[model samples]
Target chain A: SQTIHQWPATLVQPVGSPLSLECTVEGTSNPNLYWYRQAAGRGLQLLFYSVGIGQISSEVPQNLSASRPQDRQFILSSKKLLLSDSGFYLCAWGGTSGIYEQYFGPGTRLTVT
Target chain B: AQSVTQLDSHVSVSEGTPVLLRCNYSSSYSPSLFWYVQHPNKGLQLLLKYTSAATLVKGINGFEAEFKKSETSFHLTKPSAHMSDAAEYFCVVSDRGGGGADGLTFGKGTHLIIQP
Candidate 1:
């Protein structure tokens, strides 16, 4: 069975502070990883996706960035946090095959005060 | 471009009653549709998906959805609603050819309220 993990589960950051969220998948290799943010009214917005190591695609321009350091490890980072950057961030992984199904992690909640 | 619309922002249903969460999608070609549930402050968990193989797809937690191509709707249903079913539901659409690298478009989400 495949499982995804993300942390820190929750965080409180001051405005203009740095942000880092990590995601990893076990029992799978070369998985496609994605980052999504869910806000009150914005819904789930795709922030970044990775097809392989060192390859990241930005879906929307924002304060965040993503990196795939290893085949199963993905990181979402920001140099400075904004009030608008606070939301529930999710990490997902999908197989490298044709079907487009995705599995999500527990998520991280960042509260920028 | 692909998009999804969850018809109701909130739905209230009594326990043991039928559950209906409406969703419609727009895609230029054949699309892959999915239904995901989010518990408060948690990640989205997929309930079911339609990938062109089955018109009626059965998913986890006793939930099922029927794909209507003519209407471009994938509505989720359950025979009986449970208190545990109270959560936010999202409808998603994906381009059939892009795989997961293209990402998914999510609906605004419907807040399902289970009445006692």
Candidate 2:
């Protein structure tokens, strides 16, 4: 019964503009959250993950950053966006226990022009 | 370090034909493997996962995968291919004992094309 919500479903941003994408989960608490990006015709790339509030781990250095402001709320932000920052961003959550299966949100498609 | 390799970038099959997508993985320890599907413009959906409990795992939409430890491969199969099955498939691997903090490593993906 757990579900994740991400928005805005699609966005068009100008280069060098600020960016913010939000993801929230329901029916679970203290779950681990992750941020991933998929470029056109490329595989999913891990950007950041958080085990708890105020804790974030970066996998690959890029123009994006992630934050877990609440137990079930994760936000991906950038002070200034780059053309390379445009991609399909996904949010996922996994249980705190030994359960390793991750549930994904609908995702946000950003187009930086 | 754990990594996954999808042997094929594109696979075409006729409707009702058997479907197979090949995957291979490398891990230092016992690893957890998964297959995920992504529809165009949609998020990735987990189809199946292998955690060392069973070599053969069944997933949604009549899809199944077998884990061959000796070969270090987990290949996904289906009895019949459907038009709805046309999408991109990704093979993923994760370390089993590292507190599960390490995010999944994904394959480049295989594009499954269902021919009419």
Candidate 3:
């Protein structure tokens, strides 16, 4: 079975502060990774997705960016956080073949005060 | 472009009653649809998916959804509503071009309220 792990379950930062959230998947190699944000009461919005290491596609223009440092490790980062950046961030992994279903991590709650 | 629409923003159902959450989608190709549940402050859990397989897909917790291609609808239902079922439900549609690289489009969500 594969498991996805996210670090810093919850965090509170001030505007203009830097942000870093890490996601790692175990039991799977070369999986597709994705970063999604869910606002207070809105549905999830895809921020970024990576098909392989060092390859990332941004779904929407935002204050954050993503990087796939390793085959199973993905990181979402921001040089400076904004109040609007506060939300629940989720990491997901999917298989490379077919219309594979995505598995989501526990998620990180970010509050930018 | 693919999109999903959850018909109800919020639905209230008494416990022991049938549960229904409506969803409709639009896609250029054979669409892959999914239903996910989200507890308060928790990540989304896959309920079921329709990928040109069986029209009726069964999922976790006795929940099921039927894919109606003619109507472009995928409505989720449960025989009996449980208090634990009180959560937000989402309808998602994957890109027709295929591949995990394409992100899914999610519905705003329907808040399911199970009343005792």
Q: Who wins the lDDT comparison? A: 2
Model 3, runs deviating above 4 Å = B98-100
TM-score of each: 0.96, 0.97, 0.96
Those runs of model 2 whose alpha carbons end farther than 4 Å from true positions after fitting are none
Worst 10-residue lDDT window for candidate 1 chain A reads A94-103
For all candidates, state DockQ relative to the true structure: 0.76, 0.72, 0.71
Cα lDDT tens digits, model 1, A1-113, are 99999999999999999999999999987998999888765688888999899999998998899999899999999999999999999999984676577899999999999
lDDT of 2 at B85: 100
Tell me model 1's lDDT, rounded to 2 decimals.
0.90
Best by DockQ, which number?
1
Can you list the residue pairs that collide in candidate 3? none
Q: How closely does chain A match the true chain A in each prediction, as TM-score?
A: 0.96, 0.97, 0.97
Instruction: Please write out the lDDT profile of model 3 over residues B79-100, one tens digit for every residue.
Output: 9999999999999988656444
| Per-model CA lDDT versus the true structure | 0.90, 0.92, 0.91
CAPRI docking class of candidate 2: medium
TM-score of chain B of 2: 0.96
DockQ of 3: 0.71
For residues B1-116, could you state the per-residue lDDT of candidate 1 as single tens digits?
78888999999999999999999999877888899999998888999988889899999999999999989999999999999999999998888564347657788999999999
* lDDT value, residue B48 of candidate 3: 93
